[model samples]
Target: MAEYDMQELTLPNEDGKRILYPRMQLYGQKDLEYIADKVSYATSFTRGDIKGLVQAITEEIAHSMSEGYSVKIEGLGVFTPSLGLRKDKERESGEEGAPRRNAASICLRDINFRVDKELLYETAGHCTLQRAQYKKCRRSSQMFAPEERLERAKEFMKKNTFMSVAEYCRLTGLLKTTAANELKAWAAQPDSGINYRGRGTHKLYVLRPANA
Candidate 1:
């Protein structure tokens, strides 16, 4: 097999216009099936129905945002219509405590998104496949046994003390579930890791040094 170099190519579009292509992203069929399964399991409706519903909801959100209104997608995040700032706010408390110009310039639509932790975790897990591929090219082994993967995961956590589980999975090529589980296990170690749970589905992990 020939090595594939990351390259940009010009390809013809549907209208016969040539467009520059950056890169290609391909999803495996099994991965798609797994996603379908997750959707089916998480929701009350059937998989096919939920898939269509998801697409429709996304289209609706796009349409709504295009009209300048924020559309909140459940378990995902908020999309808000944004407009450029007209003027900067004065940053003065009056005289001696006076500040100069406006503290913040440019205005944006007040849209906030709090992604569903479960969904985010699930999504982060799969991005590991891409990381795995990259690692395969650079390292001698494209294959990582479960135990090795677990050990590497621990080393990764030690190196990056503050990365989110999803980010860790992407960087380490470990599935989201695997990453989360490892974090829980690490936290279980006495005097080394912090408790990782809080109110109502909020998720976080912290590492603590025993000496400090």
Candidate 2:
């Protein structure tokens, strides 16, 4: 069984006609573990055994492909290495009338996959789909006013020594650039109540002391 949501989508090119469709939300590792458990219960193999089997198969597939060999699983598909030739423009360097510094090169572009359509269709023979029980998003657009955002960060720093841009994004739902700029702006002011340390991903924001 799988769950989906009926979503209303409008494309910029479309004349603003709302299109309704079911959007599939995928399950992660939990689904795979559950399947392994069920299969183990119905067969002699244990769940651990089933997991190891899957891991072994996956490793072999990857190993074969890395060795420049094509792999084909009966119920899945074929995995083939696809090559791409880079056409880097030639530019004379070093001196006038000198030879071009670089030339075209070939590299592995991607792994090509051709699915087994018959096996996929057979696997979906008894499939079931249902609408998801929607829950409100934890955060949204205009989640907080500008002053309130700064206040929120100040309050957070009271409980914690520092706040990273990633932490602020998670707490305030602001994009990385927006959070970074806000933190930088607060830290730039001489008497502002916020300060940051380090640079880029290593940066952390802390509250400026009241006495300072």
Candidate 3:
């Protein structure tokens, strides 16, 4: 049986009313080996064969997506490639005579997956949900004011050269999304005492240069 719990919405609505939403209580992660073993017991294929096939299929999907092709398995779904600008490449919007972006500035941002309806229905058919006790939001950011958090972040960056979003969250007790958004906002402001290096998942926050 599957279990679920209610989580309070973090954002405020127009009426300033708090609301709760249902979220599944995950047991744990099942890796490739566990999946292979399960499939082996249900079919004639050995675990090794299943693992090899799965790996090969993943590699092929990556290769095809790199070549600008979307792959769709019968029972699975479509995997489409997505692109984004590389680090230091700003969008050429409203900038007069800015250098146009070339291939070097483009990168594979992500691969979008649209699940098949049949697979979704099949998975839903197997679920038996039971409501569990509600868990309170662990937003530690509530303990500190926004300015206090910024001071703490500046202190942290003084000793460390760079800080990842996860490290910032630990330092400020903020949720991941909140920490990331705040960091981006701070980086955008002039003399905000915070700046970021790199792009996408590799991004790291650093103290803004004194002269800049």
Candidate 4:
């Protein structure tokens, strides 16, 4: 089994109660070594890793949508870009020489992103300088397991297989943390599992067949 490191962080509430959370292990040894080696290196990063990340994303989208279902990068909604040839009637000068030559086009019929409420709320808090409120909101439960939490989550999975953790929480009103842990439990089963993409702030989960 691969061991994942975890960081214990204490976030203080307005009234001073500390909320402890295990932040997912972020940087690994290779990452630390790279950062160490480049201490003096300054690279311009506009969101920084945009280009390579975008290409990787495009490849993923192409892979998933090859058969036509829309693919979504959440916060960003679904996108269905198609490659096609452009053919139109045209006459150069008045020669009436049939139509123009072949031309190709990549059409982005839908490119959209819907900001998450938590993201929006955090941004607003920062902009308004509401540090206290922001901190309190950030500590919001998105993590507790209720009385029927597991059963409810499993039932939800039955109806909406392969949903993201946030999406599942959104639909079922489960705390984000609780939903994540539930899915983690489901994954631990030898004959049932789920997979997720992204890490830290951008994580999203998907259900997989038991055999997978």
Candidate 5:
């Protein structure tokens, strides 16, 4: 009974045929409330009771995973905690051939989940699909020329006093690395009217104050 935004994408395989795929839209806590109500009506429990149970389960799952435990819900999935790789870290106080690292060296970066195969298959069978009204699009940012992108960035900096790399990408639609290189290049070109400031995460692009 639920509708999803579906869009047709061309496969780059040998057949190269277009196929409709569901575009997943994000659902929030409000959607969870609706689900709790429906579940309450189906069973004897009240909506508040269902909501409380769901919250308790979520909290418990998080607690277990934090303790380096993998939890599996009967009809759903398994959630496992994992750490991120710190490849760029220099060897700080290590032996001649060995690198010294500890638990503090890396943080718990992700909690991953694997769906239950049976539940996945059954759920997929019940879904209704519909096509999106919008046309399919490739990355339109890729269409922009370097000069055009610089002009767009200049236009953006006209109002804002400073901008982060993330902010620049959001405004100009350029990817992060692309935006960084462009901003640095402009900064190196003396008297380019655009100046880069600050270091690392505190970086910004600023307009020249006209004489000095």
Candidate 6:
């Protein structure tokens, strides 16, 4: 059985009225071990064998995706690889001063999954839903002008050698996605007084060097 709740929307409609939307309440996460245990109970194979098979399948899927192929499991789903710019490798072209995007600048960003219809239908058939509680929309009170936020980031970078997206979010009271996008935009502007180092998860914003 699954539980659902009504969550009030933070954003108002054109008539300036917020409405409630249905959302599923997550119970907990089930890891690979849990799946192995469940499968082992229903099959002649041991938990170790189930785990090994699952691991091997995951590795092969990753390998195939890296080689530009999407993998589809019979009753599960299709896994397609998505690409994005590698922050560290991106650079402005000297001619147009626009960022150059090519094979070198791009890397696998994420894997998108499209579940099989039959599997989804089977899961939906087994689900028994009950209403839980009503949730109110909670909006962030920390709102600052874009220019002010940029200045705040610059000031912080002056004292600290580097700042992570999480740190920037805490310092400016901005959401994670907003903070990350702002930082990336600032770093792209050569004279923004902000730059970045590293790539992907290890990326950090830093004060632009005076000479470079």
Best by TM-score: 3
Q: What would the TM-scores of all predictions be?
A: 0.29, 0.45, 0.62, 0.27, 0.49, 0.58
Q: Indicate the TM-score of model 4.
A: 0.27
Shift of residue 195 alpha carbon in model 5, Å = 53
Task: Give the C-alpha lDDT of model 5.
Answer: 0.71
At residue 22, candidate 6 shows an lDDT of 84
> Per-residue CA lDDT of candidate 2, range 11-130, in tens?
533676677877764432245578787798799999899999999998998899888899998878899988765666344466877875432555667899998887779777966877
Tell how far residue 91 is off in model 3, in angstroms.
Answer: 1.0
Where in model 2 is the C-alpha error above 4 Å?
A: 8-16, 82-112, 133-212
Count: clashes, candidate 6: 0
Query: Per-model C-alpha lDDT, please?
Result: 0.54, 0.73, 0.82, 0.50, 0.71, 0.78
On lDDT, the stronger of 2 and 6 is 6
Candidate with better TM-score, 2 vs 6: 6
User: What lDDT score is found at residue 20 in candidate 4?
Assistant: 60
* Candidate 5 global Cα RMSD: 15.5
Model 4: residues with Cα > 4 Å off, grouped in runs: 1-43, 46-161
Which candidate, 1 or 4, has the higher lDDT? Answer: 1
What's the CA RMSD for each of the models?
A: 21.8, 13.7, 16.8, 22.8, 15.5, 18.2
Clashes of each: 2, 0, 0, 3, 0, 0
Model 5 shows how many backbone clashes?
0
TM-score between candidate 1 and the true structure: 0.29
> Which pairs clash in the backbone of model 6?
none
Better of 1 and 2 by lDDT: 2
For model 3, the superposed segments whose C-alpha errors exceed 4 Å read 94-96, 134-212
**Model 6: lDDT of residue 52:** 93
- Alpha carbon lDDT of residue 57, candidate 1? 81
Best by lDDT: 3
